[model samples]
Target: MMKIGIVGATGFVGNRATEVFLAQGHEVRPVVRSASSADRLTIKNLDYQIASAFDQSQLADAFKGCDVVIHSILGSPGLIRGSVEPTYKAAQKAGVRRIIYLSSMIVHRSAPAIGTTEASPLVEKQQFPAHPAKIYAERKLLKLREKGSVEVVIFRPGIVFGPRSRWVSDLASQLSQGTAYFINEGQGICNSVYIDNLIHGIQLGISTPSADGEAFFVGDRERVTWFDFYRPFAEAFGVDPAQIPSLPIPEFHHSRKRELISAVTNSQFVQKFLASVPEDFKQNLKNIVPKRNKSSVAVIPQVEEVKQVEHKPTPVVNEMMAELQQSQYKLPFDKAERILGYEPIVSFDEGCRLSIDWLSQLKQFETILKK
Candidate 1:
């Protein structure tokens, strides 16, 4: 058994990876960004190391004595781009043999063409900022692999979902609140990878020598659409997927106004300026500006036939959902199968059942419905 260090262990993927690795008789080191983050994972007898994700020295120290390091950090584009080089270098310093990096199929546009493969050209630009950021990080890792001191394997999975995933948990929460929606009548292809399948890919990455310096797409063998994806979720809550309400496919420019305001408000200079402003002045400025009605009509277009949704998703969420719901193709994992001997152990039906069972354990259905 090999010792493995997992960065971002508090996250959905890394947290599950730690548990799986430990159960498989491998030594597991969970490297988190803070003590609070460390508390997020509580597997018995497993201790986590605290370090800044951007610091090579700290990551090196945290990874010390591990044979492999799995990088699963997720955050802003800056954090995402900044962490790659430090992580690989730190693994080298810690004498680790290999690094498996988690990337998303989003690197190649949210809606890739049919038959898209690892070699398909990536989008030069994308609506979601994370897409470009992931592309940049993957390119950086490939460049670092030229040193030959460490083996780098990148796994690009699509819509990772299962227990504790946003696709499951967040959707459950939304569905409970009557806020869930789908665009294009939920006809889009959902290139989903069950969490356990993804973890299995990581295992393959660690053991397969041919996988070194290669990027592979890993997802379920099923050719399911977004409707197929959400139907099980809807059934779990006794809600008909057909009654979830529908949103029209949105044009990119439809959200430009909100996006501009978000960009300005989140700018560092604007934040600093707001901090320096007196409370009275800030309050006065706020009072002067017109306040939008709290119960304004939904911004995105909704089908007129279905009853209006009580709670609409935010502009950002709506746009993302629209993009995902508009997907027309699935990215193939043939390369992963050919090289890493990877196969999805959990079928879609089984995965959905397990995810809903986990939600049941949390009493989410009872708790949410009671509200």
Candidate 2:
């Protein structure tokens, strides 16, 4: 039943690896780049393909006749180093047999040392600026898998979190806009990995045949931290990881507006400065910026009681939330359980009870307590 082909099929790990490779029956296709990102794949009659993940002939015409193509592309580090050698030369011009690439135990920077793994020696100087673009897209797909043509497996995974994760709906939208935090006291080591245990190590890197050109790491068979990964989203928002507050781990500067948006996002001048802006002059520069102060001195329509401010993140979200709360260790997935016989069948208390039951089935705590 193998025919899988998931480029970046609407993200958050290629839309949960196209619903766990079409509920393990296989023959899922998702390659998306448009038609509204394949209309956010909630899965239904999918044989999807649109392409443009840095286009190698539109990803070899969306990886035709695939037998495996999971690049799992996410973006920017100039679209993950311009879509890793045009997705391995479009999975060797569509004759793909193996390509599972996801990669990111943050190329070993968000704290390692205390015996790292996956043959340690990565961190080419990082403060998690996307860890040297996932170590230049895993040394450009292990040097295009040393040119033995296709077949490359490379699942790094860690801190992938669960339930339509931006690490659990951006920490349940920063605990409903109180702008959540914790750098040191949350006590590091959250090398998490429950997005169905990273699609169960991408189905053991698609039935492990000596896991092809190997490079595992996968995560979360415990030793969890960062307050045991924010204690079930702070007990699903009653909030109290000791009144969440720490911050000492930061040290980044040099921002000529982040070096002019990282030199206009590795330029074509940020697409001609967003196509020479207009849309009502970008909605009149968002109504001339002052978020609240049209003061000609007006009276109050009083009933004040909504406070939870202390918010302090930006400096690139506090160096990626204090570099994943300064990890310090726990990234061992025992070489993905001795070469792809992987494990982690979900349990960090049952992946926070299915990530707080997918945030109460998407009411997302009643839409973040009605903002």
- The candidate that wins on TM-score is 1
The local distance difference test score of model 2 is 0.77
Error of 2 at 198 (Å): 9.8
Best by lDDT: 1
lDDT, model 1: 0.84
Give the lowest summed-lDDT range of ten residues in model 2.
Answer: 267-276
Candidate 2 clash pair list: none
Per-residue accuracy of model 2 over 298-354 as CA lDDT, tens digit each: 545684654546555442346766867877778778777877778888788888777
True-vs-predicted CA distance for residue 107, candidate 1, Å: 0.7
- How high is the lDDT of residue 356 in model 2? 75
- Which residue pairs in candidate 1 have backbone atoms (N, alpha carbon, C) closer than 3 angstroms, thus clashing? none
For each candidate, what TM-score against the reference? 0.84, 0.32
Tell me the spans in candidate 1 whose CA falls farther than 4 Å from its real position.
Answer: 252-317, 367-371
Off by over 4 Å in 2: 1-43, 48-64, 71-94, 101-113, 120-150, 162-185, 192-225, 228-238, 243-327, 330-361, 367-370
Q: What is the C-alpha lDDT of each candidate?
A: 0.84, 0.77
